[model samples]
Target: DTVSYGRIFKADKQTRIASVGIGYADGVPRALSNRLIVKINNKKYHQIGRICMDQLMIEINDENPIAIGDEVILIDPNESKDLTLEDWAKLTNTITDEIICQFTTRLKRIEI
Candidate 1:
């Protein structure tokens, strides 16, 4: 089944999909769509399909105990090296500052 606006994500079997409430409008680059890997409940999942204006989707296993309101780490240094701002910058062919600037005021910044 299709997951997002542009790309087609066809699962071989029944898959659990979770929708994240952040997207390009929230500073997530559309160029990272289908390429970004997000962390949830200490597990990593690949973001699938095209990123919407205010949301994205990730594939999860049926057994994953992810629930609503669980935190999704889009850029976490403690989780994985790939989830760093530097990596995101390289993936989008931009600098880290540009990536940082894209995050709109709508997102709450939590320093850890």
Candidate 2:
């Protein structure tokens, strides 16, 4: 998070929130909220506010680490500081399976 975000949230701009044309919608609990912080090219961004059933918003800083359609990590299981679905489970007070199953048919699997 940075000062630009603090400023932009106050103003609400389409240019400010980093988002995907696609995201979760299948019964995703809003309590996951801003807990999912994605890492891209070594920079971090918090998914803004509550995650909608069909979409989620992420903040991109002036120190942009990604471009449109660039690959990024939603949560890394191997990294020392990686965030996991378990984190979402904790935030939402739910089981890990539910968090993991949130992905829709829209997601393409990558064997990491």
Candidate 3:
């Protein structure tokens, strides 16, 4: 155990909702644990359930919203739709650098 934590993500942009593939066993520190606040269509939604080793769950109840393959912001420069890394830092008393680096290189990043 590398002493990492997990976060439930329900990020979005306008109406494109996304549930991130992230969780505890992925080196997500338990300290940074909670229902993550994702700004979608200028609103926040709750990430439901306890985080798993590979992925957590989120609610995507938008009307005529995005599909399974639609693009959603997980970690992007667009702060308007998703929570800032600074927010994560504040929440866990960590830093932005640490938070972003949490993911191992083996993880594939699909930015849309």
The best candidate by TM-score is: 1
Candidate 1: global Cα-lDDT? 0.88
C-alpha lDDT (0 to 100) for residue 5 of candidate 3 = 32
Query: How are the candidates ranked when ordered by lDDT, highest leading?
Result: 1, 2, 3
Query: Given candidate 3, what's the lDDT at residue 95?
Result: 88
Residue 104 displacement (Å), model 2? 2.4
Per-candidate Cα lDDT values, in order, are: 0.88, 0.63, 0.56
* Candidate 3 TM-score, C-alpha based: 0.59
Model 1 pairs whose backbones collide: none
lDDT of 1 by residue, 1-112 (tens): 6678855777778888999999999999999988999988888899988889999999888577999999998888775477999999999999999999999999986787
* Number of colliding residue pairs in model 2: 1
Off by over 4 Å in 2: 1-15, 26-28
Model 1 misplaced regions, further than 4 Å: 110-112
In angstroms, the error of model 2 at 77 is 0.6
Predicted model with the maximum lDDT: 1
TM values, all candidates: 0.90, 0.69, 0.59
RMSD of 1: 1.7
TM-score of 1: 0.90
RMSD of each: 1.7, 5.2, 8.1
